[model samples]
Target: MFNQLISFLDKGKIRKIARSHRAERYVKKFSTYNHVVVMLFTVFEGYHSIREIVLGLLANAHKLQHLGINYVVKRSTLSEANERRISTVFEEIYQDVYNRHQRAFSGQPFKQ
Candidate 1:
């Protein structure tokens, strides 16, 4: 299920955006895509802390491989990425995603 949802994301587009934002500059193992994946996992699972996200990923390390996650992220790595990465990269990605899917949402009515 998670893998299917992740498939909706275009990895190339993500890398292109990251490049434009220089989000991957000076990065070694952890790339912008990896950070995005980890953050999404954290949100979907309702994880409350860096420690929980790390441990959760660690526990599901085997399954994550199918999702293109080659390794278990450390708490410090996640923390550092969150602190240093440009927020605009994510904002642009969100806008692109919304634009691509806007037609599906066009007919829906919203309630205040």
Candidate 2:
């Protein structure tokens, strides 16, 4: 499921944005889209916490493998990751993504 979602994440663009992080200690291996960034997006979009995200992932873990997000970080892992890193970076990334999505759909209309 989310593995297919991972395929939709532009790896190079993510890596490029990731490079601006000044804190190397918080830097993670970017092999998947199931990270703090996505976690924040999920929360900002109304998911209450990491538990919800984990549950969603668990319900579709098998599908994630096919999408290439094979790393199965639990709720605890996600919470810890989000906590350790500063929130501003995650905010900026999510904001950029949100803006892009808005732009992409700016002139969209109903097809039905």
Best by TM-score: 1
lDDT of 2 by residue, 3-95 (tens): 333443555555555566652354465322446435634654467767777776677566555554666676665666666656665565555
lDDT of 1 at 2: 73
Cα lDDT of all candidates, in order?
0.82, 0.54
lDDT of 1 by residue, 26-112 (tens): 778888888888888988899999999999998898898888788998888788888889899998776776666666556664332
Clashing pairs in 2: 1-63, 1-64, 3-67, 4-67
The number of the candidate with the highest lDDT is 1
Q: Which stretches of candidate 1 lie over 4 Å from their true place?
A: 104-112
TM per candidate comes to: 0.88, 0.59
- Give all candidate RMSDs, comma-separated: 2.9, 6.0
Give the lDDT of residue 19 in candidate 1: 95
Cα error, candidate 1, residue 97 (Å): 1.8
Error of 2 at 36 (Å): 5.3
